[model samples]
Target: MRTADSAAEFQTAAQWQSWLSQGSTFPVFQPVLSLETQTVFGYECFGRLDLSENVASLGTFFRASDQTLNTLQQEVGFTLAQQVAQFFSPVKDARLIVNELPSHLTALTPLELPSTLEALQQAKFPLNRVVLDVLLEPGFQNPLRLKTVMERCHSLGCQVALGNLGSENSQLDLIPYLKPDFIKISLTLFHRSFRDRQFRRTLEQLGRLAENSGSALLIEGIETAEELQQALQLGARYVQGYYFSAPGRLPAPLPDFQKKLREALENFRMIRTKRIQRQVTWENEMLLRLVDISFVLFEADGLLRLNETDLEGLSGFIHRLYFSDLNGFQISGDYLLSETGCQIDYRDVGRNLSLRPYFFDHVYKLHGRPGGWSLSDVYCDENSRCLMRTFSRYVTPQAILYLDVLWANFADL
Candidate 1:
């Protein structure tokens, strides 16, 4: 097959047209696996041309002017649709995902659905088993046009997928508007973004968005065991890459694919469970130490108001310290620690915290029990812009001492 490097040899539009007209392209299927089921969920059809090594890929031939590209896309689309029908007709469960450029679909004047539908019908391929995978490019600037194209595909009873998500050209903000059945996240972007601390939060947001938008998150280009594990941890429903199998001329069941996937999943889950267990155990130990220190302070000066000096001793571990009554009303001022020193904020002294979850739900359970302390899960502190875990314990008969510890410090412990 010709590689992309031979593009200079076919500079003329006629030569490119002639090449595509010969119908010399064949579809290679790449398996898209389900992490949960550890099975092949679908196959993405890559159109490969029987050309020299210089051409590299089919995409090189279609990079001419807009008109030429559009013409080439239509010809290639028709050929691919027919090829898919021929190759995947017997496959009842797995879907055949065919690539379609958004520009080609939007540019079709009278629409070219009839010819494709007729071709699939003649080849005995089911429309429901077909997925129209649209590549999001910068040229696709009009949302309405894209929506029209999506509607046309759905009207033909085929599922729609938006590919190249998170790529440079991908319109990430338009995902909600497109509402595709699958959002194919680029592996390059996924890896680059994963290095950031905020990546997990962003991934979680995307996962929720996909769930709410009724779209499945498909992480493409998963080439290693680590990548597969990370994708699974981030809640990817569909995964594709060389980790399973590279693109091939024929589609078949992978050798021991299910077993390998299940084992990897089991290992990932076990590691994740152990990590969480360690975190919980460490947090419990820190909370116990804090509780002991609080009891010592309480016994030293029975029910006395805690000032900046008293909180300074524990400032290295605690972020905020305050005392609340049995009804969850703040009696003492908030003593907060900063880089400079501990400071007392007297304004928060008469505020009621009874409605807060840590006080009303968590601490209330341990109200009457002696030597009992309630430790909260790690939560974001709005004031400090840091993760905090609140540890509440009954210091006196009428008061409860609340210690807000920075999770970062606790993690170090």
Candidate 2:
């Protein structure tokens, strides 16, 4: 509970020396609960200073102090499993989650058990009962070293987690390679993203990233019912916070049968159903509009022949409309809609688009399945930096038509 402002009291020369000595710290276990079952999935271990009322986290202090205390920090975590191993003897599926920092990984030998983990095992705690919450900062580390260390953890039968997802220190680039069993997003980062207009968009991306990595989302620091709901909405299966129980529980407690979980889950399901309904309606309306656009293009005879009058009822959401050949080469000018109204742009008339998945995949996929259109995943156009999706269909015998729609086109959820 000690604040960093008062940390000066512990920064004295003698206190710093005391920090290097043993018995200065011990482990506190915070429960990570599964919202679906409302049960304890695991308990994340923290290194807390063995001080009286104003006790502080050793992990927090060492991290902020830029000290070489990774070894001591990890010792506290392993002690949690050792000291509390008897508690989980009844809970066959319970795990003791621990931090394995970047420095720890770098110091480790390839495919070798970390010294603390080795000690934890000697205490009879199963490696499978350990979830190593790993981290990577924005700065680059030796990729080969990380790979070896990660493989070592996995090979030893431990579940590895990538922590700090969505935070400033989050290294999203390393996620695919690390292939963590869980992607841990802190509560602070998740709440900060709520204020962004693109929060939903970013959430979808995070979901996809977790999906592609075959990882479950583990969101922590959940302190309230609303926060739990938000974490659930973010697709987090495992969550931790004071709302369930604070850290330092000598023997981690059992599931307390929280009514809050049931209520949040029911609300989550209801809200999700309504959101899904809205998406279905949006898709149907947008598909109809695309068909109407195809009809307009047919009625106009050609791209250049189309004018502002041609976009009469469809200029609202359409960013641009163009025709491309089967091989994905644009054959016509764009009927682009602007704030000033629709205008024709011939700049990209002969542009090659064979490599563009939006164009080529649409044409190829719809080869036999005619009379239908394809809607692409929302993406940011690097040129304009606008969120866009391509709706493509064959409007002419020799060319396929594409309508670029802004992401704001009713995917409000």
Candidate 2 stretches with Cα past 4 Å from truth are: 1-15, 19-24, 62-92, 110-112, 186-188, 254-258, 289-308, 338-340, 354-357, 409-413
Per-residue alpha-carbon lDDT of candidate 1 for residues 1-413, written as tens digits (9 for 90 to 100): 33443444776677877766554777788998888787898998876776543224576554444475555566675776688787777766898877766766666554556344556766778777878888777656777887887887788788988887767776777788988998887666689756864566567677778888899999988888888888877779888888788888778789977876888789788878988888879767776667547333442223337435544567667788888887777887787887789777877767787866477655656856747777876666766678778887777777888888788765432
Q: All predictions: root-mean-square deviation over Cα?
A: 5.7, 3.7
In candidate 1, how many Å is residue 348 off?
Answer: 12
TM-score of 2: 0.84
Q: Each candidate's TM vs. the true structure?
A: 0.75, 0.84
Model 2 C-alpha lDDT per residue in residues 251-312, reported as the tens digit of each score = 45556635767888999999899988987788788887666553444433344334457676
Clashes of 1: 12
Q: For model 1, where is the 10-residue window of minimal lDDT? A: 294-303
Give residue 132's lDDT in candidate 2 (0 to 100).
81
> Per model, how many backbone clashes are there?
12, 0
